[model samples]
Target: MILINRLRTVLAVTAVIVAPSGGTVLAAPSVPAPVSAAAQPTAPITLRYEANRRSMLAAGIDRPDGDFLLFDPNGRGRVAQVFGDLSTARRIAVLVPGMTNRLANFWRGVGGKSYRSPAVQAADLQRAGAGSGGFAVIAWLGYDTPQGFDEAGRANLARAGAAELERFVAGLVAVRPRATIALLGHSYGSVVIGHAAPRLPPQVTDIAVFGSAGMGVDDVAGLGTGARVWAGQSDQDWVRWVPAARLFGLGHGAKPAGPGFGARVFATADVHDHDHYLSPGTDSLAALARIAGDLP
Candidate 1:
């Protein structure tokens, strides 16, 4: 029975990779060029935020509920919303989401659930770290994310996202040279972080992933980053059932939260499922906040 289940899992994952629509194979989209480091230092963070906000307004896009440092409505859409004043922040956290996210549901979430909304999750993290002082959080939807299980089973989208994420962090580091930064990713976002890790700047002090299937690597050393690595997975997460194996570029590889992956494991007992890791008052959120705020 166990062997039959394992085989079914493999076949199902393979089907997604080869023919996500059940009849047609889809080609990966072209990755955009990384943001140039030269362009970032030209403007302060505040100026950038205002300029993007103005652009969004002019484009007739509805006003964002909070400050946005970056916004583009083209294609699958991209945005980076800030939770606090970036200019005065000494510590910053960038939260990356997983599959099925786009501008259409960036604010309200997939089904209007606060826990799944990137903006709400960032706000929650910001509030969790409010006492830490000089802290800010950015809900970063800077890449074209995979829309379903078919794309999620592959690494092409993740590679493209990694390039974009690397550049976004570079811009942040350029603007706030002295600020400590943390990268937090959930689910397939963790795969993006795994690919971006080796290229990220030293100012990024930590990387945390929750409810992850894998980071597209064998272990922390495979990430090739000097920053500390953290992982969390609730027993209730369905991702635990995903095969932690990489085959023919199909799976994402070993789970980061599992033993032997070399990440500092954190408790997620309060998290009820994959989407609840960043929910308010969860132990996972508190731990992530501490990492982002540079608290012990």
Candidate 2:
């Protein structure tokens, strides 16, 4: 009989609790039901072209020059896509890559992680600048680059690419007369910068090399470019172990510090693999940031 009475009491309480708002008996309010599809937070965008385009615009690059402005059928823009605009920037970085590298090569990252390209590199400098407030960067692959690293093929590309590099610099200066540009070369890209350094406009503020085999110099003073020269090579870099003999015989390779090449070598005690020089938290990259005048 007691159990039966308890059950009756529970039902009565539930009925009162769910009673309508205007009922005589006071009752607890009903929980609100979830709304329909029109009300959820949006998922963040992961990979989109807007980030790239925004970075470009923020850097003051509007389009490419001359015949390069036309967008090709491949969705790649003309030469303008390669050489971005250079207006109003206090500091600029021209990141040059080596062998088999095209515009897309700069995006490579470790363990398949997502990373941005040199364009992204430029954006990063802008981001870094936003914090400390004084620099801009550009990813420069605007040359007739070779596709592979066969000895003969590389030598030819070196000579031919140098002329193109010189022209690129000249063209950039024609527009932004006062912008300070820093030439940053990676691997064989270092050779390209070394060759073109002497011929570049006076506006170039520095020449920096990372993971380089050699920079075709006898000493730091020999680098013809008037800018401050800097180098960063990791201890485990294979370039450091490359046989000097291979570069000695009638070749384009020259020791960056042998005699005339003027470069301040940044020690690589904290850098890891060949490509990690620019990675966050590495010592070599930190030195590069200092040379580029960026923050920690």
Off by over 4 Å in 2: 1-85, 104-116, 129-131, 151-153, 245-251, 257-262, 294-296
lDDT of 2 by residue, 1-296 (tens): 88866766665555433332112333234322322111111111111122233333433445322112111112121112223323455566667766555533434422233232444454444444444544655555555455545642245566666776777666557555676777788777787887777788898888888777665555555566678888777767767766433343433454453233446787678876666666666666566766665344
lDDT of 1: 0.83
* Model 2 vs. true fold: TM: 0.63
TM-score attained by model 1 = 0.85
Instruction: Return the lDDT, model 1, position 23.
Output: 24
Per-model TM-score, in order, reads 0.85, 0.63
Clashes of 2: 16
- lDDT by residue for model 1 (1-296), tens: 88866766665444333321112323223222233211242356655655566557666778735577777777888888899878889999999999989988998997777668998999999989867478999999988899999899999999999998988888888778899899999999999999999999999989999999999999999999999999999999999999999998789999999899999999899888889988777889889888877887
